[model samples]
Target: MGLVRLVVILIIAWLIYSTTRRWLASLDQKWDQKKSGRSEKIETMVSCAYCGLHVPQNEALQAQGKYYCSSEHQKRAESS
Candidate 1:
């Protein structure tokens, strides 16, 4: 009888441990997804026509329908 009780207790303990581990793992995965989702935006990248350097479109300078990394590049492109 004592042996049976010990076996049952060990089974219960293992079940509880496994359940807790799975729950914690799921929580961790959800946190990672939430954290990554914050910066998961697709930005439009444009290349500077003068030097072929790529930059995010929102931060690039636009002149004559061409993208530039800086004003100097834009002026040089316009001159050339």
Candidate 2:
């Protein structure tokens, strides 16, 4: 009886340890993916043609083979 109880306890302990380890590893993978996504977002930025300012690609104005922070800057660059 004593041996059977010890074996059961050890099996339960091993199961708990394995489950916790897998959970932690999954959380770590999610964190790494989130960090890489943030880096990609930073890398997707564009520089303004008029003043060399960095702006997000979605917000920057694209025209005439150049990027600008605003439409006014795009017109200025085109006029000049």
Candidate 3:
């Protein structure tokens, strides 16, 4: 009886370990794919027309075909 109990416990442990390992591996793979996709995205760097500061195109404000680092700069340029 004691041997049977030990066997059952070992089987349960193995099953838990296997499932946990597979789940963690899947999570790792998903994270790696996400990271790779992000790295592959087109990164555009543009200089702010107002201050000549370099910033990522995606975050810069675009107006009149010019990129600005902030809305304040854009408004300042437009007002001037």
Candidate 4:
């Protein structure tokens, strides 16, 4: 009877440990996704016409059907 109780206790302990490990792994995965910016909404990326550098569309200056990464690039493009 004592051996059976010990075995049951061991099983319970193993189950608890396994559950905790899985929970921790799930939390780690969520944390990694947040830290890596995977949890954020995807933005459209556009390339600068003058410099050929890629930037997010919302941050880029749009003019004349062209995108520029900065106002300076846009001015340069307009001048040239």
Q: Which candidate wins on lDDT?
A: 2
lDDT of 1: 0.91
Q: State residue 62's C-alpha deviation in candidate 3, in Å.
A: 14
Per-residue lDDT for 1-80 in model 4, tens only? 99999999999999999999999999999999886784243457899999999988778899999999999999999998
Give me the candidate number with maximum TM-score.
Answer: 2
lDDT of 2 by residue, 1-80 (tens): 99999999999999999999999999999999999998888789899999899999878999877899998999899999
- Give the per-residue Cα lDDT of candidate 1 at 80: 83
lDDT of 3 by residue, 19-73 (tens): 9999999999999999887775546688899999998878899999999999999
Stretches off by above 4 angstroms in model 3 are: 42-80
Better of 1 and 4 by TM-score: 4
What's the lDDT for all of these models?
Answer: 0.91, 0.94, 0.92, 0.90
Q: Model 3, residue 12: what's the lDDT? A: 100
| Local accuracy of candidate 1 as per-residue lDDT tens digits, 1-80 | 99999999999999999999999999999999987765553347899999999987878999989999999999999998
What TM-score would every model get versus the actual structure? 0.50, 0.80, 0.54, 0.53
Q: Rank the candidates by TM-score, best first.
A: 2, 3, 4, 1
lDDT of 4 at 63: 98
On lDDT, the stronger of 2 and 3 is 2
- In model 1, what are the clashing residue pairs, if there are any? none
What TM-score does candidate 4 reach?
A: 0.53
